[model samples]
Target: MSGGPGPGRWLTDRLSTLLVVRMALERTGAPRTAVAGALRWMSPAGWAAAAAGLPATVAGRHLGWAELVVAGAALLAVLAAALVFTVGRQPYGVDLRLSSARVVVGERAVGAVVVRNTAARPVLPARVELPVGTAEVAFPLPGLPRGGEHEEVFAIPTARRAVIPVGPVRSVRGDPLGLVRRAVSWTQVHELYVHPRTVGLASGAAGLLHDLEGRPSSDITASDLSFHALREYIAGDDRRHVHWRSSARTGTLMVRQFEETRRSQVVVALSRHEADYGDPAELELAVSAAASLGLESFLEEKDLTALTTHEVLPAVSRGALLDALTRLETAGGPRGFVAMARAVSRDLPHASLVVLVCGSGVPVRDLRAAGAVLPAGLRAVAVRAHVQDEGVASVGGLTVVTVAELDRLPRLLRRAVR
Candidate 1:
């Protein structure tokens, strides 16, 4: 005898059909109770009896009242349980919080989220979806207690400076039977900032500036209140500095020689105009050269200033100068080299050393135009590379040094300063 159908396969097929019908009803926003009621009356027995009624011989006796009633009652009980579970499940919500809204580049930052069950009963959220930039992390909140909170820490990458916005964490709650799921969004926003990276060159490279020009090679030049060195009194020596105490003790006139101290002012200007090579690498090289020169000058105890075309005032301190260089790496505008040079010249101290870091092929006319306006006694050095012109010569009152490679910058700078 051939069996009509396997019980397991029959149940699976019926479940699939019921699922399809439920989805169709849901799409049309039909009442779930009405759909459930219709499904309860559509039992296997009803289908079988309907088929039997189609045959001519069994048309009159195919279906009986008892079997239809029993099968219909059983389906109604199953559907009643499903409906109770679906409507009785609790709802959940999530909220995210951040410690700080703004942060500096290269600094660590933190973010936390709290999950709460707003419904009267507890809910076991099966999964949670978070929009965490380029990647999604799904959390399993299987036993989320009512009004409970969960916290997590994520590392923020700050290789560059920018503003970042972080989420409205979404909570996904599933029914106990896993037959239905619901999602809810929370109102939560966070902002993070990454501060710039700074290098400490004050103490690391302090000794590299010994024996430089324009300053006496003594660290304690300013501490001359104490006796420094005894020397023969020469004409025009200060009368107050006759050293009478020392002269009387030694039976001879003596004079005190104080340490010599002088201040050297240095002005560093960067050409912000687009390079001839049409590449950013050359611009970066120019910025790095400017920074290196400023730091070196400061290390030598010289008052250093960094100027760009867009700004009227130049940066004075080493840190401020470096920040200015960072800004120049991203700045774009028309060629204002002559304007910047003239501006710097007006404000620069007399007898200062002016260093111009520019790309090659800059109109010699522009350099000559600015040089004509420079203050008298100011020594100017122009650091230019072959990036624009193949053959170049020295400009008026300026020493022209060309760089064919980036590695030669340090050497070129050393020569220019000397």
Candidate 2:
């Protein structure tokens, strides 16, 4: 969100820059393979020792012969160990396992890596580097005898909601001299989803249901099952549906009228376009809103359908919904929210309700227009994920709620029923 775009895109862009640098090194005959990959870097101690030894080796000849001999020997020893460390084969059969792949904000999670020595002889101590998002952690491994395994546990950060890439663990090997280092990646990449915090809307379920089901709109016609009221019989009216009491009293026929009713289904249309979200805070708020509202709808057992700029998320169960929401990142889609609205209008014309969770950059007029495009009698509610002093209001004839955060959504939802 800060550098280029979303986290994934920013990571890709950063890695591209690193790749360009590595490619230049490879062009100059640097090794790109694991055996002699250029991923290695000299530690501070290595650089300092080399710099000191070079001058001592040069000036010691004129100053003192003993100084010259000692400095040259130390330099040779350091270089010899560095070369040996670079040539040494890394420990094999390393495996990384995580406690869980999905969690909420402020929760704790752990990752364990098992280092195995499959060589015939004892494997020397080595270093392990694990990638977590844009950062890496390096820890030391104890020497392991052949066929022995050692496991190390590390804490994963869950201070915020994000999809943290956990692994592709790399093993580092270097001598005590800290001269040349070699790293070989052994494990595959795994992602952890730190979902945003959400509040349960269990108490507000009735309000949501009433809005979805209770209506006296003329836009909806009576189906065979849902009865409304009786009115004077019109031409070609079915006599079988005529009311005998009203006809006998007034000498006029009255037919039974009904209001159309279908199985209650709610569509949650979330705008995930990066432009729509505007900023990181707005993006997070928008996602939280979607999650909370969708969960409440699902808890109420209404047929819930979730739509994003990318596609419709599976709402079959809570697990599926949370997983889908956790993976929802901002994107710059080719089409905007209007396109998504059109899609919903055309495909879900019979949906009893539609909720649009928009971001900061989205205009209220545009959302109102989007809601206006829905089929007749299909109520539309717009929720803006932005900082606001007022909780709810009407905009452009469409009901809109401006929420500063996700926790206020339930109150506004309940109030909407009034």
Best by lDDT: 2
Candidate 2 structure quality by residue, lDDT tens digits, 368-402? 67767777666777878886533767765457777
Tens-digit lDDT track of model 1 for 46-84: 444434433422332346455555555554444444344
Root-mean-square deviation per candidate: 19.6, 13.6
Clashes of 1: 5
TM agreement with the true structure for every prediction: 0.45, 0.69
Which pairs in model 2 have colliding backbones? Answer: 221-260, 222-258
For all candidates in order, the CA lDDT equals 0.60, 0.78
lDDT of 2: 0.78
lDDT score at residue 199, model 1, on the 0-100 scale: 35
Window of ten residues with lowest summed lDDT in model 1 = 198-207
Off by over 4 Å in 2: 1-78, 119-121, 146-148, 210-261, 332-335
